[model samples]
Target: MALARGFADPVHDAQAVFRTVMDALARPGLVRRLACGLAPPAPLTPELAALALTLADADTPIWLDPSLAGCAAVSAFLRFHAGAPIVANPAEAAFALIADPGACPPFAAFAQGTPAYPDTSATLILALARLSEGRGLGFAGPGIRGRAQLDAAPLPPDWPERLQANHAAFPRGVDLVLTAPGRVAGLPRSAQALVPEEA
Candidate 1:
């Protein structure tokens, strides 16, 4: 498809998406909207579409859980422009894009840091919904003096526990990007994640 026929050229759109991600990461926990242009296959939202364009590149190897694989056409798209390799498992992935964070596997199932190279852990980009500030919960850690509230939806039942376990490893847990329609918030492995107390 050509940009001439109501189809946006991906390379052109990727630039804007890149800016969104770069700035979002630079600021941490801030919300920024990204553009989504892919005529993405099923189970894909604009959030996930924009993310695939922005973060994937030649140097990265991405692992897509079953939820995301039908678009190998998109995979071919990545290989052509970004040269990013697609891998079979999370352990082999530099970046893992999760379509449904709620049902996504535990952090332990994916790669954590090795003693020699703690930074080897994965970077997870999660496509989420109901993006709002973590208004009710008190969140603290790097980049905040006391407690900072940012939008953080609840993950799986054990996700909070898993994140705590990941944090205990410090420089080892995966870095995260939580995204919605057009906005995103990052939870660097350095940040402490606390689930809200239910009312």
Candidate 2:
């Protein structure tokens, strides 16, 4: 019903959020908290809202998950604040926002940029129940020295396999930004997502 608020200081806040996102992406599987406070509609966390604000622009087409799409408040907030177009087709989107990661389509369904233009691929922003250290899946890649683990509960069962497959695509796969109440984590296409071994 009511329109949501954007950052208190647009320029500075956007820059701060953007920096946090860059840090998260640089260090895969590491969680970073956003200082900005936002109240987007249900299913969209503040972390996710901040992320969209920082990344999405008028030229970026965003694909919203069914649950998020159905919420008028969320759509209005995003449209008014981010000025990002909402696209019906996932493949055409530059950013895909998923409120329920377990209910999301397979990772392969989204756009995977061509080898010559890997930056054209879509970035997935997922809202998770919570994020913590050393519990769910393992990660190792670029910024990681050895290995890093993420506790992202309620993720899709096939996420590890999918992430590995995505990583295997090398220069042509989508990247992921996992968000919680106030924290976010990166799962770049270059990172390897490993299943925990039996204890």
Candidate 3:
């Protein structure tokens, strides 16, 4: 049902979502779950859809990959809820939400900001099965000092390679927000990831 019985639920949910987002960004390497339940359609999972609702608006430009089966459904929902502009290509997007990362465009194809204002790069929000945990690639950098693992299953073979290239761009590469069933993690501009050595 609708959450707004009064001022309390909406206020609380908003605070919770905001807190989750803040935690994701603040920690940088860990995934924090958002409270999700707003179903849009197939392929565009509830958690991802909730994020779109929480973070987007008319000012944001979003790009949707063709892999998401509910493009029309998601587009209509976004138009109704966020009023955000939906672009046809990834390069044109400020936020490109991808349900299937394997088919996603190469990192070089997206906008890597010019030297003057390298921070103008795009943010890619990818829908994942889990954030990251032990036995996976270890990450370290700005927010992380030592190392930590995540349960990032079923990504493209070259995802880490792509990220490495993106990282090399210094201040110009795309940032990432990986969301799963209820959790998400934000990988910002300053972090670096180290893949585990295979024994």
Candidate No. with top TM-score: 2
Error of 2 at 37 (Å): 0.9
Q: What is the lDDT of residue 166 in candidate 1?
A: 75
For residues 21-82, could you state the per-residue lDDT of candidate 3 as single tens digits? Answer: 76786677786767665666667777666667667778877888887634576777666665
On lDDT, the candidate that comes out on top is: 2
**Candidate lDDT (C-alpha), each:** 0.69, 0.88, 0.72
Task: Give the higher-TM-score candidate: 2 or 3.
Answer: 2
lDDT of candidate 2 at residue 185, scale 0 to 100: 88
RMSD over all Cα atoms, model 1: 3.6
lDDT for 50 in candidate 3 is 68
**RMSD (Cα, Å) of model 2:** 1.6
Q: Compared with the true structure, what per-residue lDDT tens digits does model 1 show for residues 73-147?
A: 556655554568988878878788788788777776677878689767888888877666646344568765566
State the displacement of the C-alpha of residue 63, model 1, in Å, after optimal TM-score superposition: 0.8
Question: For residues 1-199, what per-residue lDDT tens digits would candidate 2 score against the true structure?
Answer: 6777888888999999999989999999889986777777777778778889999999999999999898888888999999999998999999999998889888777899999999999999998987887766889989997999999966888888888889999899999998887788888898997766679
Worst 10 residues of 3 by lDDT: 1-10
lDDT of 2 at 16: 94
**Which residue ranges in model 3 land beyond 4 Å of their true spot?**
1-15, 196-199
Q: What are the root-mean-square deviations of the candidates from the true structure over C-alphas?
A: 3.6, 1.6, 3.6
